[model samples]
Structure formats: C-alpha cells, structure tokens
Target chain A: MSAFNTNNFSTNGYELPASVGASLKPEHFASILHTPPPLGFFEIHAENYLVAGGPFHHYLTQIRQNYPLSIHGVGLSLGGQNPPNLQHLTALKSLIDRYQPAVFSEHLAWSNHGNHFLNDLLPLAYNQQSLNRICAHIEQVQQFLGRQILLENPSTYVEFTQSTFTEAEFISALVERTGCGLLLDLNNLYVSCRNHNWEIQPYIRALPLAAVREIHLAGFHREIDPMGEALFIDSHDAQVDDAVWALYKSIIQQLGPIPTLIEWDNNLPPFSDLLAEVQLAQTILDAYNTLPAKAQP
Target chain B: MTFDAAWAHSLLNPDAELPADLRVWNHSDPAIRFAVYRNNVVASLIQALADSFPVINALVGDEFFNAMTAIYVRQHPPRSPVLAYYGADFADFLQDFPPAASVPYLADIGRLEYAVIQAFHAADMPSLTTQQVQGLLINTEKLAQLQLSLHPSLQTLQSSFAIGSLWFAHQGAGNIADVQPEIPEALWILRFQLAVEVLPMSAGDCQFLQALLKGQPLGAAAESVIEAEFDLIRCLNVLLQKELITHFHYL
Candidate 1:
C-alpha cells in the first residue's frame, strides 16, 4: 500500500447538502476548489487518483474539504476469473484510508483477464460459478475498505446464453450474500434494456431497491448495428438522452432522493455545463423530498 | 478453457473462436456484437496511451500513432488497470516496433512522457526552502552524511540522444529542426496539475540526482558526478530552486 497519513478523514466542512452529486472531473478542479457548488458529494473513479503525488492529490485535498466524496472503481474487475488484483485493492484502500469517502463503489464487470488488462468494462456471464466468484471479490473489497461498497451494474451490449440468472437477480443475490450496497446506474439500465430488449420497470422492481445507496446518470452512444438493431453503448460522452431521463424520473420517483450522480467522463463540457445537469437532478430530488410521505409512490 | 478466458481472448485475437455456449440475441450477429466490445477495449486503451504520450502522438500524427498503438496494445496489454500509469512498457515496445524505428528517439520521448505522467501522480510532499537547506549543513561532517529527499513529482531522464530538445520543440519552446545533438542530455520533469514542464540539465546534475534518487548521501553523490565542470553548491541550489529536494536527513 502506498504511504498516506491514516484517517486524515474529515467532513466536507459543511452539513451534508442535497442528495445530488456529480462525477468529479479534472477540468473543474480549479473552479470547484475555488467555489464548491451545492451538491451532496462528488464521486471519483479510484483508478484516476492512484498516483504517488503532484497536483491531483494537492487539489483533491483542498476540494475534498467542502464536498463529501464517493470513490468509484472501474479497474476492480470484480467478475474476473482470477482473484481481484490485490495491488489495485491496496491502492483503493489507501485512498479510502486517506479520504474516507461517503460511498465507495465499483462496477460488476471484469476488465482484466489472464495476464492482460483491458481498459474497458467487459461483461461477464451470470452463472452460479461466476456469482460465487463475484461475491467473494465483493467481500474482499469490503474487507479491505472496512466499509460497505455499492456494486454497480455494468452497461453491456451482449448477453451470455449459459447464464442462469438475470443481471438484476445476480446483483440482488450478491447484495444479499455480501451485505454490499447497490449503485443503480440508470443509464446503464437503460442501455442494457434497449440492447437486450428487456423492460426497465421489471428489472428495477426485481432489484433489491432498499439496498441501493446511489444512482448514476450518464449519457450513452446510440448506433445501428449491421443487423439494423439499435445498440446503446454506455459511452458517457453525449447529453443524457431523453429515454434515460425518463427512466431516471421513474427511478427517483420510486426510490426517492438517493444520491444521484451525473457522470460525464468523455467529451466533457465546461464546469458550468455539468453544473446545469447537476441542477436538474437537484431539482428532481428537491421535488421528491418535498412530496408528502403518503403521496410519494 | 473457461468461458471468461475465451471471451477475453476473442477481444485481442479476433480469430480466437468464441465459446460455443456463449449467449447473445439470436437475431443479432454474435461476431459484430462481440466486435463492439473488442473495439471499445482497444480504442479506450489507445486513447489512454494517447493521453499519456500526447507529444509522441503529435510527433507521429494520429494516423501513425493509432496504427502503431493497435499493434502494440495487442502484443502488450497493460498488466494493471491503473490506466493513468498504464503504458509503462510502450517505450520499450517502440524501441523494437519496426514502424517507429525510423524515429529512434520517439521511444525516448515515450519514456520521458511516462516519467512525467508518473511523477504527476506521485504523492505530495513539501519541498525544503533555501533556509531549510542551509539549516541542514551545520558542519561538513553532518552534510557529508545527509540523504536529501527529492520532491515526489520530480523525475529526471538521462538520454544519450537529444530528448529535451525534441520535447521542447514539440511543446513550442524551440524549433524541431533547430535541435542538434551534442552531449548526452538530462531532462527534468515536474508537474503542477495539467501543466508539466521539462528542463534540460547538465549530465553532471543528472548523475547527481540519479545517485540521490538511489538514496546516496551528499558527499558520495557529489563524488559520483563524472563531468569535469560539476559544481556541488550550484547543483544543490538548482535543485532547491526547482523545488526538487524535499528534505535532507543525516544518516
């Protein structure tokens, strides 16, 4: 593990704000550090900050002072055939030890296979054996972090024929066995639903909603394959599509104010543009929170 | 082979047959669906290598870099998932890559970019001020045994070729055509956010840092400098001024 001053953990120097968050980006470092926007917290991809020193840690230390942090991992490869890489886990543990983010999460996909590591989040077949491995990996991650981490459902273009369980069923079972939380990336849900022709409502209902600790809202790329099928790739480059926004509305209406993260990793706009998206989420969350308890569905 | 291994293999080697039991929609072609993933896996990594070594990409142009990267990534997929520190072996790969061989110094540029990016991610430590440097030298005996701690983001590259000039030319500091190789150059890289600056150093100073980086004490490190014009006090001040030396601890 890299050396870090242990538990230098402190609050974002404010009473927690709203339940809407934005995935932190390097482009907004100066602006966010100078004047933090009103959001519950910021989520970071754990792999981005795995360096030993320099401006990343320097600015993060300062910005983290005002916003609660959520460290998300894309490299954990939780569903890989081999055990999750210990070095990746160690780097994650060090970041967690230093910052103590409010929510720590990683995708359910596996990127590393054999000796080679792929940068993309590749899908895995959902079978009992795969389930056993993923559960074990999630347990290992939580043990290292000493905190509950939410496992995110990945955006996949294809499905495996031999898999017995649905994605929702698989994630729900992992949550049950490991006591891990769920980060329902609504955009991923939308993309996978379209690609596989699965309905969003039933999948969302089948998921262990109570265990959900956060929601990810990102945009996707839509293209027609050679077979003339619409393939919704979770590209996270464009604006949140209308279909995704509708799904997000339905989800928040049901879930009610879970920490919603607006993730824009590629083709990033100015900080103000991201803020505009965050504000939209904040508005929906505010409206939901204001609804009478009995009226909320 | 396990199903996961088959799927993973199919990505890099398109000829690797997919496991027969693999699932996809019956109507959609499995090959193309799988190809989407293969494209994503390859493209994002190429993008990552591009991000890490942009100057190299600028020098080679996107068309050449992309072609070189496509082959390089297939042969040498990253061993770890920390994408920021990915492409550690690209420099070595370039040294052997036939297409990149025409620009032999391109690999050195790759190496320099890797060092710069790695240093950028290094942990932050407060560099010592001039007063702190003076305070450590209470006496020659004490100074002789002092092992100076270099700043976390400070990295030096000593190349037999003109790495600094080529790099400076790429960053708009000098004309690429004006660069002419003379002596072996030591390039210094330091980071502050998106900004990274590379400074050319005398061979003697590079030797001095190389020794200090290996945890050598001051008196012995100074003696290791091979250049005849090496000045101990002046080299120490250059390091101090550049915020390279974090602290000096006596052994």
Candidate 2:
C-alpha cells in the first residue's frame, strides 16, 4: 500500500452533506470513501471487524484496499498481570498479515486479569512489577507477530497512590525494553494531564520522540462531579475540540509531521465532516512543512 | 508515587487510592475529566455487554439492563480490553443475579449468543465434500475407527426451554406468545456466509453430532444416534447439508 500523502485529495476542501449530519451507518461508508480526504488513510478498531463473513468484515476489506489503513486495537490488555494471550495474539497476527496495516497499535492499559475480561482499557500500576509485565507482554507480542507494534497511551480517569514512576518514564522504559514505537494520541495526553493535574508540556516533551511514529486526535465529551471536578471523557462522539486540535498542532510542530488520524467513532457526523477534519489536519501539516527550522523553536 | 507509575497503578482497581498527580485535580477542571473517563469506562463496558447479548438486553428492557450491567461491571470487571470476549461469565452471573431470575431464560439466551460468537470467530477451514466422504465411507465396516472432522463454525447447545423458538421470536419475527413451546431444542448453530444460523436439531442428529464432538469414531457416533432413534440415512443427510461433519479419517 502507498504511504498516506496529504496533498492527494481534492484541492477544494470537504463539507458535510446536508443529508447525514447525525450519523454515518455502514451503507454510508462506501460513498464516503469516494469523497476522499487529502490525507489518504483511515484507522479502524480491529475488533469491530472480527467476524466470520459479515458486512463489517466485507466493508473493511473492500475499503482497506483503497486506503492506507491502520488497525488500532482497544483490547489486547498488554499490561495485565498474566502473560499475553496466545490466542488473542495469534488472531491479531493473522489480521496484521492479512491487512498489512501501515501501523498496528494497542493501548498501554490492561483490560483483562485472568478468566475475567474488563471491556474498558483499565489503567495498569506503574511500579516495577507492572512495567516488567508490560514489557514482557510487548516482547511476546512483537516476537509472535515478527514486527514492531505501536503502543498508544490511554486516557486515564484516576491514578494510584502506589505508582512509583511517571507515565512518560514508564512508556520510555517499555520502548527501551521492547523496541516498540509509540502512537501518540495527543487528545489522550491533554485529557490525562487535566485529569491528573499535571503540566501537559513536560509530559509531551518527556516522550522518547525518536520512537514516536503515528498520531491520533479524537473528540471528547466533558463530565463533572458534584464537587465540580472536571474530566474530559475520550468519548469520540463529537468533533475534535479546539483544545485537542491545538495539542495536535503542537505535537506536529515538535515532532514534525506524522501520520495523523482523526477518530470520530460515536455520534458520527456526515462523510464530508470527517473529510473536513482530515483537511484541517492536512492544513496544519502543510503549514509546518513551510516553517523555517530556526523560526519554530 | 512517582509520575511513571501513577496511571498504571490507578488502572488496576477502581477503588485504589489516587496518586498525588491524579488526586491534585482542581475541583472545576479534574472532575469533568475524571467523570469523562469513569463514564466512558462504565458506559462502554455496559454497552459491550448489551451488544453481545442483545436478547438479554431486549428481555430485561433498557433501564433494568443498564442497572444489571452496572452491578455486573463493578463485580466482574473486565480483565481484557476486548469487549467481544468480555461477558464470558455473564451466563453464570445471571444464575445468581436476583433481578434476572424473573426472566429465567436469560442465562440460556446468553449462552446461545456466546456460542454463536465463538462459532463466528473460530478458525477458518474447509468442510469435507460429499464425494470425499463417499470415497472414505466405501469401506463401511472400517468406519468404526474413522475419526470425523467437524466444521470450525459449528456449535451445538441443548436447552430445556423452547430457547430456539424464544430466540426466533425475538428476531423481529412476531409476538412472544405466538411462539409454540414444542419440544426442547438442541440447536445446531452454524455460520454460513455472513449469517449465524441456529437450526433446531432432531434427537438423533443432536446425539450423533454430540458424539462426534467428543472425538468418537464414526461407528460410535452413528451407533449413538441409532440407539437414540434409528434414522442413520436421515441424520447423515442433515450433517452433509449443514456441512458439519467435515471428514472421516482413518485412525
């Protein structure tokens, strides 16, 4: 598959078709591809397309041929207490072999414990034990797939008091141990920073920039408690907020342009709206390309 | 706690004490952030359970289903991030789930749905053709030691309630009362093309497939069916059409 190029799309930018502002169903996905965005790629959750021979799998396979696809996995609890699931690993490996995604990624969070499976990307303890477990899991996964996998940072709600290391340090350790690249979800960083009351700049800067390969920007809904405490939910139900877009711009400025994807899963707008989001990212990337090196720092 | 271990430790258990960074959230800013994560964690999980077991959700209604999922979510929290494989133990949970007892058939429905999902994701393999089976079965007496291969997408579930009828009724077919109880159904669930099909099995067919699944030789499998009801030809025909019995290999 060709590497995604932002300049490939129609010069005239995209707009949401009047008919589909509320939702984009399976039927709508086919037409949406024809009105392609400048950024010639799409990222889909791997689990959503795991079926024997259904429409989900059918559409994914059809669209995958045309687009520079990336499979973002939400499951594969890489930081779990137990070893990486061989069956799950085998299944994932099969998918990678089949699709040949430009980037294959899973979260740093643990979702399963043993027999029980937590559907959410639950946080993992950042002590030596957890770090060791995550590294081991990543190594096992990389070995099984015979390829490097990108690990995305999750949007966490709460932090444990027992944690002995910073999130960036933990991720850096994993990269060092497993040689896996990073899929920096800027929106997650912003949400996590606000939730943890940490400075976002230091956290972003602390990342092992050389290992960073891809970027994700998703929309979030705001939630508050009775105490008036704020949480930016990574709901992916709306358009990329201005704050998130700003973060994306900063990451691009620092890291140079990367393969960026706009994730709008639930509460989806029309095909044109998705293309517009891609156009916005492309515009930012184009601006970075023209900037002088000395002028940027 | 150091910054590195902060988020990792928080994810292990929901009630784990918050780290300094996480706990230091300002009332105005952090609450929304925390609520966002918390709500997504709960809602997405609940939604996954609802998706996998649509019948359970439909039977219980939205309010009760949401409530049941909340309690289930807290008690048997997901250990994996994959929601498709999340609710494996939900059937067992329903047995002790107090509110769900009113809908006694809920657990069986969950089991059937789980089986269907398992069949759908099972490894890909080709079924034995009629000609291939015939070539092997030419030596009928030798069939006693022949091990039969089954389709990867084949699943069999035996339920006392009219689960097949009940499951069918909920498929936007018609009213629940219109479903006749008939006899208990040992469903032969198979995924052909894109659809997961649940076909009601006769007593003999169920026994024969159950025997074959146990790795019994063809002779034993057939004997088990003949003992239940001597309809060997009819059972073989059904198995052939469903493409369940893949091959009869000599052991």
What are the models' TM-scores?
Answer: 0.92, 0.76
Per-residue lDDT value at B58 in model 1: 93
Per-residue lDDT tens digits for candidate 1, residues A107-140, read 8998887767888888878889899988888877
The models' CA-based lDDT, in order, is 0.81, 0.71
Return the interface RMSD of model 2: 5.2
* Highest-lDDT candidate: 1
Error of 1 at A245 (Å): 1.0
For candidate 1, write residues B43-130 as lDDT tens digits: 9989999999998999899999999998888888888777887888899999998877778788888999898887777766777766
- How does model 1 score by TM-score? 0.92
lDDT for each residue of candidate 2 in A220-278, tens digit (9 for 90 to 100): 87865556655567777778889888888777787677777777877767777877887
Q: Report clashes for each candidate as comma-separated counts.
A: 7, 38
lDDT of 2 by residue, B122-148 (tens): 655567876887776698778688898
TM-score of 2: 0.76
Instruction: Identify the leading candidate in terms of DockQ.
Output: 1
